[model samples]
Target chain A: MNRRQFLSWLRRLAKTAAAGVVGLAGSRWLRAGFLGAEAAPPAQRPIRPPGALPEARFRAACTRCLLCGEVCSAMCIAFPSRIEGSQPPLRRAPGAMERQELAPPVWRGDDTPYILPWKRACNLCMRCGEVCPTGALRPIAVDRQTIAREVRMGVALIDRKVCLPWTRTSWCGACLTACPYRQRAITVDHQGRPTVHPEHCVGCGLCVEVCPLRYKAIAVDPPFAPDRGAVRAE
Target chain B: MILRGWLSRRRRRWPGGARKVQVLRRTLQLLVLALLFAIPTLSLYDNLRNQRDEVGIQSRWDTRLVHRLVADLEEPKALTQAVRGSVWTFKAGELVISDPLAVVDFVAASRVPWDRFLITALLPVLLSLLLGRVFCGWLCPADLLFELAGKARNWAGIKTDVTFSRGTKTAVLAAGVVAAVILGNQVFAEIYPPRIVGAELYLWITFGTFGAGAWFFLALIAFEIFVSRRFWCRYVCPGGALYALLGRYRLLRLEVDPVACTECRLCNVSCELGLDPMGGRFGQDCNNCGLCVRACGHDALNWRLGLPPSGGVDRLGHPESGVAAATPGEPAP
Candidate 1:
């Protein structure tokens, strides 16, 4: 072959090699969970909307259409603007425009819908799933049985150290009154201290919103949270 | 041949078809813009109504008009639920439509047809196959924004003549697909302007804030203003690339009338994508927006229904170079 043709062949070979290298690196990254685990620890991970797929699958499935947030009646769902770390829940309201300017984390889909239950929890209305075209959030029926069975967003845990009833400061059954699952998810003892049944709790975070404490004695933790598992196991 | 003749005859018979198409395109563009704002506004009203019952608080914003509009409809449930999602993945009840690029990104990343992705993707795929990159011209909200940005640049006395290879878009598409496959995430949806515009608008309307995607979108607008004209759609839109590829052999193509032709170059100047309509060099890039057809003072450009010609529209001015060459019996009118 002439020198020109030889050079063209060499160029083609180099391009193929470069493409191969990129493909290899991408696969390694995917397998290593570069887009998933390394970005945020389990504890730092934001609470996903109800009926959402597991973190990895949700990231893959969600096109970040923002429909879930649009349909949220409580106006609870929020998309993180920061590239690496999500802002604290209470901080979402103030200076929203400035928050939007923050650089998003590199590896994550920036449009995924997350809820800050302490500020505005999911109403268990199941509208987000109905509107989610991607099935990132499975369309769960609004029935109590179906929501309780299918939805496992997280579980509510009461901090005895801070809770008024548990601390013997006052008779507080705010969480029990606010719990959607009522007797099934939360119950009060003779002394009127509210207890959370982790197995029955759907983690809707109604208790967290109505805790009536400055620090919020009751909070929702992801079902896989290490401390939650330990508490359940214990 | 008979169907082609009838179609061409109908187009000719439809008085002012060229101008009508442009008007229709603008109307559709405006309709899409209206829907983008309206859908989220209605949802906001619905959400706030629900909030009133659940949270025992009055909705701060007044939505009396939205309530009246919804109240006028006999059945608002389907209207509310069916008409959701952004431009990336629009759902009209059982008929879920998605952008072709989003579909490719999802499939490449997940390596699975999760949910109704394949079904949702089918309509846009078919649309591009028939009409070419019509979405970029007719319905993309970002297209409207980019055009306004271009006009603003003109008004501000900013001149940007920068140009890049059209193939850059295809390369970007390939790279995006590869990156998505490796990263196991939808890459194009994260950055595509049309999707970003829709998602950002929804965020702003519903939550009174924009996502980081809004900043990215604004940066793109700024780039278009300062660096290139319609930069994303021309040189680097992976979605536009996918649409171009899918619509490569589209049935409807822009044709120039050789007989009535005055090489005024107005059509070329009118084309947003920098395609050569004066020379009929649109190839697979003409969005069938019909802007060139409307721009022709000589009334030389019109839509033709058939497969793309073997080598682009026959060299602009040659007597035997246009549709007449293909259908021998039909002389130039």
Candidate 2:
């Protein structure tokens, strides 16, 4: 090879080496971002699908393939859209476009599926977990007992002020009847007032869906919420 | 008889079987797109029966013909599940296959089992090593869209030749992987067009509603049509960049025989990625689409197995010329 040929070869080599170094540096930076320090956790805990791992681990493991959402029979599982003032915990590097959105938006809990009970309630079909390619949502049996034990979607909170039976406006046993756990999780006393046993309640939200009152008498709160004395015995 | 004679003469015009290969490629692309759309539709119909049975709803209309046809064509649940992902499948207690770029992100962000990595990332990596980014040419739905855009641009006489450094895609891929790790999610998977197409179609058939991601997909198509020609695949797509890197020194490469040189620049025009087959300067950017090879009327350009010299020898087999020949790394000007 002559002088000019050697220089051209060296230029190509240098370019390739530079790319390799950039790739390595970027990867190292990312690794540091992931393992070195943790970002502040989101303030509000969204209700995750059944069998979901803890928040941090769930985020790490999920590939965001949307298989869980696709397999849901109840169509209860929904991804969060862009919500103002809520940013995803993962921070993009400087120069990355903020408003120029891609697949999952920048909202906290955007890619992960959550059940909104008012729209539709999880019937404990267990199909989401079953179809999850990544084990982010651990696959559990579709049996009622299994779901009641393994799935703690949320806790039921009943407002006595709004409840028809509790307010003495009407006798309503709808919540008690709709509870998948029936006598164990929910029960109606002689006065026809339905009481929720938080310890047994899986918070599948069937009661919320089936409530006949104009305003929902019972609402499902996120699983981690502290129990308040909402349900009263006759 | 005159029409038949004219047709035969037209067929005889292009020699070296170029038209035949072009037809084959076009057919394959269309068939793949059709299959992508069909799988979800059939799966929806098959599951609809079970749904109706559970609800105890009976239809008086005898739709046996449509039902039977769909049922016959319906893919197994496991197979349908596999198709849910663009590059990975976890099925029957095994990680079936995965794209290497996804695997890189998965490994970086999460603690996946070693066996899972071996099962999923190994085959695609191996195939890419041998073939060199053939999937971008043969499988990617974006390629079809970009080709149509290119055709439209040509028809409309829009001569927009925007070029970025070939390294831009590699940089983008690296940045994307880093972002995925930081985000603790495969964000690239969400924006990837082919996967989005499949996911959108699946959602539409299953629930009659699709997500906001569908709008993102439409925006990308529109950008391809109006803003840049093949920009996403050429400069922005992380998956394509990863494949190109993996298959840089691919086994099956375009070889131009020096002796059979009738220096026609048709091959140059035929390359959608702007590679120069006549000059024998194809880099990782060449998707091995065979369009340039098909365009070469001189039977000079063909896919051959063997490593060509990095940069040496002129068209007449003479060594050490005045100006150095263009290396694969150097993009065509």
Candidate 3:
């Protein structure tokens, strides 16, 4: 109503405008932390299995309760979006990585290394687990994201050309039975040795778990040093 | 007319001395009832009206039982004004008898403003400690509901299924505390046991689907209608349990006048909390509804405010007789 009050109002308006700009800019910038481009390439991030909690329990169990997000020692547990009908599709099971991009085929890949980068890993302090009342992640559970498991022992390769099922007319469905993602994710090839489905296979080495062969035909290639060859091309 | 005539005839049948006593007791009963029922509403109404006018406001009354705990948590700076907001915000030497968090959160958030925390949490506990669950029997809304429930039970021919156990309430209290600690300060306000189920419903309906503020309010009425009796207060309320423990050693308590009672079973029938007010452990979970007093066929039972005996109930008067036999003096509880 008065001149001084008007000036004070103007000051408030200016401060609010500045805050708005900063807020927008901050959101845009933080995308680097969240998005697939800067954080992990879209394919590398892992998948969260379906039907974790119904949409209601997700929100009912929380009041924006504590600053679980802010207090998190490891940034693995962040508040899910408060958007309209955007709660779930959260992870039902505990895996190494979470999918950043929610496009086709759900999440990226487990143990892809970038999904949970070696440095930015969950410390298993149970801060996130303890805080969640709905038991999304139990405080004490065997199915947890452990840093030790993801270290690459070697690369695994299949003899796609000569595997009995893929090459010939025999019904040798050995590999399909052994695959871990189970329920026949690995298809029977022409001879029926089993051809790998890239979508289903997460390179967990479970198919290689049971290969009944003399020299262990389906095996991991041990990681090697380039200097072991001792050759100088230059 | 017929009922009034019947009651009048019943009175006439009694002795002249007892009839004279009945008239006096009835008048006293009416006044006490008005204080118990009417004044709380008036206090609320006047408190609101005075707030709008700001000139002829009632002098500030403090009931700071829990407010002191909340003082250190939320606003340590504006303690005075914050304390001034609730009637329970009385100052004391390094201690306040108020649920400060409730008052602080209510006044501060302005999101979910309620007076129940101070009234239910602070006032009842202090009164219970001083006068032993006076509010439970006298003033609280939940206790009021429980009285209605007792009548409803009789009408429906239903009986309580569970025997008394403090386990459920103790667990609820621990859970509320742990949740508050894990969640946030006063985060337990969701299940505050009187807000009580309304806020939880509000959270469920509002957050789970297409929710709005109004829908949350709708959740409130729906919950109040469906929730059976004082289930929350009796079994699950942390605040009620706290008051129960605090009032354990209270100086003044519900005393039986042995000289007065006619064994009419009116005291047991009148009690909303199902306490045999004439029997031992009369104060346990007694909401002090005074229905027992009103129900007395004769002016037998009165909540005589006196210091509890040295051996507690041993020195107190009983109802089965008609003369005061003890020393004409109050003994310490």
Candidate 4:
């Protein structure tokens, strides 16, 4: 190569090296924004669609295609960061707090799907899993047995403090009526008090939707959450 | 053999008819764009119809057309069940096709074994190796959008000649890999234009709202229109960089005819990625999009298979001697 050509080539190489260095350093900084230290609390964890990989893997696995959300028959699945009509970000369901107050990792999951039960609970139709290209949500069969055995989004916890029947505030069996598993997942006692079978509960949140209390008497705790049957004792 | 003879005869009859490749490309682009919207729309319709049937809510929306259309298909399962995902990870039936860059990102970030993606990633890998970034030229939704942005800018009488080093995107690709490995996230996928475009369309069609990615797409368009020309694809796209690298020793490539020579430089201007076809500078960056072939008034540019001649120590491997040796009228090199 000629002297001028060699000099230009050297200049180009330096520029490329500089760019690579900048990109590497910038990406490290950008990673801080892309993911946070694993500090997200259990209760605050959004109920994932049925057959989802555990939270950590799901975050990495999901391409954020939102195909799962697209094919959702019940339309219960919602993206956490959807901006509607130029307004401020919509508030999540009653139990979920303002996004800013949440842990950083929870905010990082903004692109993924979450089932907010108070707004719309998953009917456990198994459609989301069917369309998920990534194995983030493993496709499960539509049969009752498969769903009962495999789908464990969470367990339904009925709070006696607010439950109308449990408090003897005039016989409310709304949860039992709404439960998809009926007597299997939730049962009504002779005194008309309702009991939740956590093992049987697929946590579809149908009971949470039907609960008449302003503060829902029934809540689905994600399976990974600590102390699954804490409410059963109370 | 019969088809080849007939095609040659047709080519002789209408020399300019070779531009049919451009027509085919545009048609494919439109079809892909339509399917991008239609896939989500079909899913939304199915979701709604299923809801109506089970919940017994008498809805006012119409489903007859979609229902009949799907029912008429050879396999309705192909559209709804099998045809899932964007170009990032397209699953058409059992053959799951994933973008090569996404496969790389997933491997680096997830620490998953290559076997996990072997079946899913086979098609795109093979395609890039053979056709050489044909996705960018013939299929990418972003390519279509950026071309339109160029036209719109021209119509507005706006001109911006800003360009960046071609190596910049390779650096960006390197940076993204480093980031993904360190952060355990597909960081580039968030900013990658085609994925963003497909996802934003799906998001809007299904949910009636755009994510923050929509703004990033719009910003890219605006930047292309006002500040730079084909900036993202030419300089920033990690996917494009990855494809360029994979397709570096690609079997298919553009070859310039020295015998039919007139260095008009029109082909250089025609290249969307700012390649120099007239000067015989077609490199891995050349997508073999064939726009330069159509642009040459002299019909000098041709799609040649295999490598261009490795003539001496010439940097570009310019095939002037090879072309001269092949042509009857030229003196043997």
Candidate 5:
């Protein structure tokens, strides 16, 4: 995204952050001190699975494509604007202006994970790596394979108005054509726009790849739980 | 005031005796340096021997009896010392180096700054060992620069002497020593005056350590492009003069016959160091690049089978003719 959109997103993200902190404080106070009459929101609605190992593996795979950053419903993942070159942890910046390798240092097949700072701290979304053709990131079997947890492209969100599947209006099915899912998560409507099935959405954000809009109709989004907010690192 | 006046007068008279005196002075300097270098070398031999027996490092010169004699002369302190140095290849690290102390000393008090070490090492050796001093004829970053500058200068119709002060290498050596003392190990480490072996240890070490090594390499590349006549290899090079000095005393040296010289001056024009091979001095900086020898249409400049008829070979032993046509110590005539 251009600087203007990035700034706007930052502004919107700041407001979201403030609202989240207030909600977290309210919920914690009610659950502990107030009577148990009030039904509280499920703090841990495990999405996909007990995905600790898989999430770490996904982080390893995600290249921090702004596709995921743009699609994040909760916008939990924060892409760093700057980091020191010396630190190994901050070395991975998504969209860094240099070529990168996938699994570097050991698997030396055209290592593409480097120079692109987006390589590190990906929020279990394989969108950026998927966008990369250089194998800086790889296509992995995220769920079904039961072997190693390879990063699958994270959640793809659809804008109901623009997306053909959700809006029930006439729209093209190009995003449906782009997505790798067999049971089409997105469907076209009578109008020329796209529609999304939230229950079926795996959050791969491949629709963003074909989406003509700068902020894709279908894109990857980071996990949003205010209690387990992302720990900002230098 | 007195020194300036004397230098001005001497500069005006570029006589034969002055040239001979310069050669003699350089030879003396070489002798001193050889002695200095030998002391550490012998100690290194002993270290190598010890390492062979205990540390499993095989010795190349162990069987040679001369090593024992050389080892007797070295001080104990000159054996185990390590200093900041760069080796490019994994082979170098594996080879069980015999001269750690000497290499350390050379790196620490490098006759040239770390940046210019390549020239500093190669230059003095070129002058002392063979007359073919053009590392660029074989290996030099400055040669690349000079090639660029020569094209530029030709376009501009400019011709300036690429060669300059003879003692400039000594000054460079002194500069390197001082620089090393002031700046800890890595001063001007990248693109040093020595033979850059392979990937370079400096690059590997400096990546996570001192940040300057990477920048120094970039700067050196830029200097190589912009500098006129490759001044980096010429005056600024500390090792070149040391090599020139060493070349004077080297077992093998270049000599010429004035009687045979048609004085075509092709050799002069072709010389990368700007040494006029026909200019009577047989230039200490002469790397015997043999451009003049090749350029000679007169068939005059062929390497002699042995010493010249004039017996100048006695003055410099194991003489090498310009064309490598000459034999060693030809009859001592």
Candidate 6:
């Protein structure tokens, strides 16, 4: 191309780049200001799959290759569909909404993988971490002790009101039997009431999945800051 | 025999160096696509075996030809793990090849891993500087889709002259990088069409399903086919925009020789990017695909080093004027 045409192209490119920078920065500022004001405190922190880095660092590092999700044997790792609280109206038939609700809450996490234990609990295969391209999930070995020590996926919380043994409805030991750690992580009292040993539990959610209660008697609460202060069981 | 007949027909139609270059480029694109497919296919086999072993079930397909061909190769499985990503991979504890724009976002948002960044990001940048957006022409799977879309558009007899400003891509690149920084993620890489294509293909091969990212890629393809031609690459792709910027001063470029000039304007029509090659006015948008060079029956358009010929009368005996050379209907340079 002629020199003047080339020069004009360069000028136009620079102008476009400048416009882009300004437009993006301005839009982001507006979004942050507007969204930040109305944003509610998250109801619960989602359980990141084992070996995940801290939330912020994980967000920054993950390229969303989805390899982790693909390799997950339990298929517990799920990508969040949309931003939190912006759930799209279910477009299925009229009666399908109830079925949708029963099918698991639409995870509001980012495209990063998180386990929904009630649906499918992680078996501690550790394949997701090994295949993770970014260090968002650190590769760890698939041993029980290593997982228990290193993987603090979440802390399991049992609701005594809902638990069959605790509520004096029917004696049940499903959670204890399903616990990979069995006697170490979960044990039954003399009355056949199950008690969780938080220190020994890796929170893989096997028990949560196995719980036969219509609404799970045991739930895995993701490692939230304030919750860490309370020692439920020694 | 039918394939050989078609090949002979194609050879008769193009019949030259440009045809050879096109063939080579197509082969390279296919090779890249196959290489991407290989990674997930191997991983799927290994994953399946691991799962089967966990349950003590033996998969009967272990003896199949496809399995033997893809999984039996020990090196590829090891290599797949070592290079477990598209557009960017962490190999041997170092970031191997990364899209330049993603690197920019990573650096802008957080501390750069200097050593990995150099090899992953700068290497691609340096190659673009030398070769000029050759990746778009040779390696990008999206280009193959776009080409197919172009063919479909022609087959459907849809004539569109919709042209967008070249500056739009630069703006997109700028916006994407800034957004990535603000979002604190490689958002561009996540949605980049080529990367998405590779990832989706991998996911489909492994899991028998596509991810949400596949929808974005499908949308891009649909837009290209129905709305505008090559719109993603021309107007919106940040990766292409980054490559274009790096390729601005590329050493290798299309140079029109003023000697043997036929003002046929075939080259102009042949240009998918709408560059006026007959007037010797290929700007930054020219991907150097050599299509125009091949289309020129007079052998006037050819690859040359440095800039186009400057300050001279055209072979058509018109005064070589600045910028005016690009005016349509002007005699060919």
Model-by-model DockQ, in order: 0.27, 0.13, 0.01, 0.22, 0.01, 0.13
**Regions more than 4 Å wrong, model 3:** A1-83, A86-234, B1-125, B149-151, B182-187, B197-229, B312-333
- Residue range with the least summed lDDT across 10 consecutive positions in model 2 chain B: B54-63
Model 1 chain A scores worst on lDDT over the 10 consecutive residues at A34-43
* Model 6 TM-score on a 0 to 1 scale: 0.73
lDDT of 2 at B248: 73
For A41-138, candidate 4 gives per-residue lDDT tens digits of 12323578999876667766776767688778788887755221221112232322342243233443346788867567888889888877667788
Q: Comparing candidate 4 with candidate 5, which one achieves the higher lDDT?
A: 4
Answer with 1 or 4, whichever has the higher lDDT: 1
Error of 4 at B176 (Å): 1.5
Cα lDDT tens digits for candidate 1, B159-184: 86688878889899999989988887
Native-to-model Cα distance after best TM-score fit, residue B57 in candidate 6, in Å: 9.4
- Of 5 and 6, the candidate ahead on lDDT is 6
Ordered by TM-score, highest first, the candidates read 1, 4, 2, 6, 3, 5
- TM-score against truth, every candidate: 0.78, 0.74, 0.36, 0.76, 0.34, 0.73
- Candidate 1 residue B157 C-alpha distance from true site, Å: 2.6
Candidate 2, residues A175-217, lDDT tens digits: the string is 8887889998988888988888877888788887788765566
- Predicted candidate 1 versus true structure: per-residue lDDT over A1-234, tens digit per residue: 999999988977886687589769966744443222212211133578998876667777887777788778778887755334333222222232332343233343377787766667778888889888778889998998988877877766666777798889999898898889998899999999888787788888888778787667766665432233344344
- lDDT for every model? 0.73, 0.64, 0.38, 0.71, 0.37, 0.66
Off by over 4 Å in 1: A1-45, A82-109, A223-234, B1-16, B51-62, B72-82, B113-115, B311-333
lDDT of 3 by residue, B248-308 (tens): 5666555556567555566675554445665534544554445566666666555555554
Q: Which candidate wins on lDDT?
A: 1
Runs in model 6 lying further than 4 Å from the true structure = A1-46, A70-76, A80-110, A123-134, A139-149, A161-164, A167-174, A177-184, A212-215, A224-234, B1-8, B11-15, B53-83, B88-95, B109-118, B305-333
User: Between the candidate structures 1 and 6, which one is better when assessed by DockQ?
Assistant: 1
| Pairs of residues at least 3 apart in sequence or in different chains that clash in candidate 4 | none
Chain B, candidate 5: TM?
Answer: 0.47
Query: Which ten contiguous residues of candidate 3 chain B have the minimum total lDDT?
Result: B83-92
When sorted by lDDT, best at the front, the candidate numbers are 1, 4, 6, 2, 3, 5
* Model 6 interface CAPRI class: incorrect
